[model samples]
Target: MNHNVILTCAVTGAGDTTAKSPHVPVTPKQIADDCIAAARAGASVAHIHVRDPETGTISHSVEHFREVMQRVREADVDIVMNITAGGGGDWIPDAADPTRGGPGSDIQTPRQRHEPVGELLPELCTLDCGSLNFGDMVYVNPADWLREHARLVQAAGVKPELECFDLGHVWFARQLQQEGLIDGDPLYQLCLGIPWGAEADTETLLAMRNRLPHDAHWAAFGIGRHQMPMAAQAVLLGGHARVGLEDNLYLEKGVLATNAQLVEKAASLFENLGARVMTPAETRAHLALRDPNTGHVVEKAIETTAGGAA
Candidate 1:
């Protein structure tokens, strides 16, 4: 079992969970406040997704991202911001015409999906590896578009959190690595327990873990009741943990949870599991991530100095 772990809080996802839970943040200020709260509660990173303040629907506006980033950066606590570039890929076919997009179909060019990440320059952002049957709709992420998106993230000096929902997605992520599109030690988020994707069970998690590159920094999360259990499993298997309203909305059976409460629970659970939950600064050093706010290497520059001294 791994003795050290990094806990990431997926603050707010693009899903329609806002109406279900009052704790889910909607406005830019609310989202930024939740990020700070999660960091103070012991989250090493905040995986963020923005929504329209009025409609509570998903949005890809760069200005919205800017406001959220500004609020987080000016806060006293420090945390790595990880935006979602996986929006604008939903495809719900029309009932009458399969060729025409349906009510929920929201598809955009690779550049359109990447506007926020390109403009805001967060330290980390997610790249959904491939398409999947996301419930009633299809999450459309083609290989060529992914290649183009990877190039955009690479050019912007932002590291991507490779989000794989299945074994095939993992294969494609490895392909991206082979094609020299991903930079440095890639960070992988093995997303489990989504419909028609990978199941939330030990056998499947183990299989996905075994398929990952030996050098990759990875984490796994399960939705609903499987959240905490899978997080504990991830730590035991030498990987990090992710927990929050984005994946699960409960502190217990029939009990709603805030983002901070879930992160706090993860921190406590990981500590008792004989694993040390790493801080944000420690996590950056461990992954050799650069400081997005200052444009400095978090650890590699120090390593280079030490090497020269030797």
Candidate 2:
């Protein structure tokens, strides 16, 4: 295993996991606080997704994003922000009238999906590369829509993290890179253990990693029980790792975990494997990420002096 590795903490996701775990942050303030705690626990990057404060449902509101970003900035944490552009693509077909739109369908144009990213202008954003059966409903993002999103993210000067749920999605990501849609070194997030996407295991991870572009910067994450194991597997395979309550809520078999706990476990796993976890400033330098407001590459010298074992 390599000595240098980056750790990303996904603070909150768009999934409907609030009902299952009370620790999942619903409001913007709670989410921001959770992100700050994760940074303090040794997370270099934070993947954020906002939810409605009143109902705990997933939301793409720019106002929600603005509040979270403002609070995090005020806290003066060095964590890199990575917002989600993967919403507004769910479609639940009408059972009675198959051609008509269903009750739960939340389909929107590519422009709508990217509105939050345009407004927030975070350092990193996700670009789901392909569509698949996301449980019962179809999560739709056709090639044309993805192409448009790629162009938009590039124009906004935000790095796009190619989110690949399956092998085909990896191919599409490479195609987009070759077409000059994504800028700089392409970054990928290999999402495993979903219903209709790739499964979580050693063979699947190895196959997917082998298929990625040689120069690509990539991270892999697994959902539920596979989360910690996948973190160890990813580091052993010479790739980065991501973890949070969004993917798994349990610290043990019956013990619920906070977002910071998950990050701490991931950091410890890296150390157990003889790898040194990089800080946020080190991660920014490693990935060549620039500050969104300043338009300058983030220097490692500006990081806080606090240090601890990963």
Candidate 3:
């Protein structure tokens, strides 16, 4: 288990949850502000997904992404930006014609899915490893498309976080690593408790953790009521943890939560476990990331004096 633990806060997801909870940030400004605040609350990274402001639905517009990026850049926070390339894959099959896509289906080509990452060049971007029945609609990402997406991310110099919803997805992620499409030590985000995905329990988490590459930098997250418990489990199992309104909206039973609140809760869990929460600077060093803004290979440099022992 890696002693150092990194916490990520998903600021605003591309989910239709504006009406479900008031804490879900709607506009770009709100999302950016929430991300900055989450950083202050001890989140080293912030996963972002933009939404349509008026309709309060998910959107993949570059303009929306630009707005969020600009605001975060202008702020004094030092959080790592991780944009989503998992959009444009949701496919709702047509009832009348099984072969055709239904109204909510958002099937897009690999290039289309990665346009935002290419344009923005964020420090990290998510790459869902394979297709799965995401609720009623199937989140489609054929192997060819996934390979293309990974190549684009690697070429752009952005680290790809392989998001695995199930054990089979983990196998595919490993396959990608073996194929050399993903460079450096890979990062995995185990998404648990989502309907039709891996369940949120100790046994399931351990099995998935066991299958991961020994050197893989990984994080796990659970949805709704399992959020905090899964965070603690990840920390105990020597892995990083993620929490935000995107996966869980409730702080407690019948209580709505903000992004900041979720991050704070995770921080407390880290404290209880006797593990220190890493800052963005510390996380950057741990991951050995190059600066996205400057193309500099940033490493933690050791300080030495002229004399060994004054």
Clashes of each: 0, 0, 0
Ranked candidates, highest lDDT first: 1, 2, 3
Expressed as tens digits, the lDDT of each residue in 1-310 for candidate 3 is 4346789998778777888998899889899999998988889899999988898789889899989988998898888889999999988879899799889888778898899999998888999999888877788999999999999999988889999999998889999999999887788899999778899998888888888886687889998899899998987887889999898899899998888888888898788778878888777666767675677756743221011010
Best by TM-score: 1
Number of the predicted model whose lDDT against the real structure is largest: 1
Cα-based lDDT at residue 299, candidate 1 = 76
Model 3 residue runs over 4 Å out of place are 300-310
Off by over 4 Å in 2: 299-310
* lDDT tens digits, residue span 60-129, model 2: 8999999998888889677889999999888888999988769878877899989999888888999999
| Per-model TM-score on C-alpha atoms | 0.96, 0.94, 0.95
Q: Write the per-residue lDDT of candidate 1 for residues 93-206, one digit (tens) a residue.
A: 999999999898899999998999998888889999999999889999999999999999999988999999998998899899999999988788899999989999999988
For model 1, what is the alpha-carbon lDDT of residue 59? 85
Model 2 — TM-score against the truth?
0.94
CA displacement after TM-score superposition, residue 151 of candidate 3 (Å): 0.5
Error of 3 at 35 (Å): 0.5
